[model samples]
Target: MGVSKLDILYRRLLLTKLFIRGWGRPEDLKRLFEFRKMIGNRERCQNLVSSDYPVHIDKIEEQSDCKILDGHFVSPMAHYVPDIMPIESVIARFQFIVPKEWNSK
Candidate 1:
């Protein structure tokens, strides 16, 4: 399914809140989880939180000037915002499943 404009707006709003509040509130953390789930990145979000929650929060704080545009992350330092890849394309690029038969070879 294609990302809706509402989703993009939601993400932008959520990130804005995070940038302002610094993720200290439980409500904000819950919202962050919801945002990650919406973007199909819950696992990565969890990993970042578990590995170094403070650092993760710091990174968001550092990107205070960044913006989310139609699901693409845009940084002030970047001259161009790259196109957002479809979910299928992203999954195909990162997912590697070895055939079961390969184990017996």
Candidate 2:
């Protein structure tokens, strides 16, 4: 099945939270930008991050086969990069938020 709207919102929320927590890199910001473009509604995306939109974390966990730990979603499929690498490089290697289906598209 295709990625659902909830999936997209979950990703947006995760990215926004990451940025707020100072874990975001330039590449992560770019990914958020791409997600905004895909949604075609910048205001809605902003509202989503700003409001409690009920993005079901359990559903996301089951769908993506990922686990949310310490407010960070960890994906087994994501590449492992050393902390010695620059934040940009580490962000580039990790695809933690976006679904694989969207990545293929």
Candidate 3:
């Protein structure tokens, strides 16, 4: 029943309020778009922009000064990889590539 509600909502401030910036502020979010951002493609975003979620690539640009929480908008290779993986991990993996020379270093 956990996934029964396919949507969760939280805002940008929640991260700060929880970690470094403390204030007992266990936040209440009307919606939380926790899904991973695909790597920089405009087409996919065009499709998802109409989706019911709040945190899609298209939506971020609408904000006055939207601060990207962790990574950049990754819409390029959305369908190429597994969808079930955590968004952060997917992005981090994509952001970093182990150099072949590092093994020798």
Candidate 4:
């Protein structure tokens, strides 16, 4: 193979960093940690609630004269600079994507 998996992972991480910055700053790191506890294993990745945002974004794109920028952070701190969104919204929608073993006996 010409490409290394490590290289690919790095490239993907680079893209992720760009996207995260594109959203601006993390509103509440404390809230984020609470989310981490719910999700388990702390991973500081970009949070985008597909269920809400994708649909909301599509409708906005179709409707308004204003240019829709993906989605906005609903958190009070993030209201001004809502780029990264927040994990709170996703957990609110999908519940937790807990492992099968964790759920079943």
Question: What lDDT score belongs to each candidate, Candidate 1 first?
Answer: 0.41, 0.47, 0.37, 0.41
Return the TM-score for each candidate structure.
Answer: 0.22, 0.22, 0.16, 0.19
For residue 46, give model 4's deviation from the true position in Å. Answer: 24
Q: What is candidate 1's lDDT per residue for 1-105, written digit by digit as tens?
A: 567899888657756756558634545545545554644765554443333312111121122444322222222112111223333443221222233234454
Which TM-score value belongs to model 4? 0.19
Stretches > 4 Å off in candidate 2? 17-21, 26-105
Q: Identify the superior model by lDDT, candidate 2 or candidate 4.
A: 2
Off by over 4 Å in 4: 1-20, 28-30, 41-105
Report the lDDT tens digits of candidate 4 across residue range 7-98.
66854654565645773333443455445454453342234233454322222233233333343334432432343365665322221222
Clashes of 3: 15
Off by over 4 Å in 1: 18-105
Give the number of the best model, judged by lDDT.
Answer: 2
Clashing pairs in 1: none
Residue range with the least summed lDDT across 10 consecutive positions in model 1: 53-62
Q: Which candidate is the best by TM-score?
A: 2
lDDT of 2: 0.47
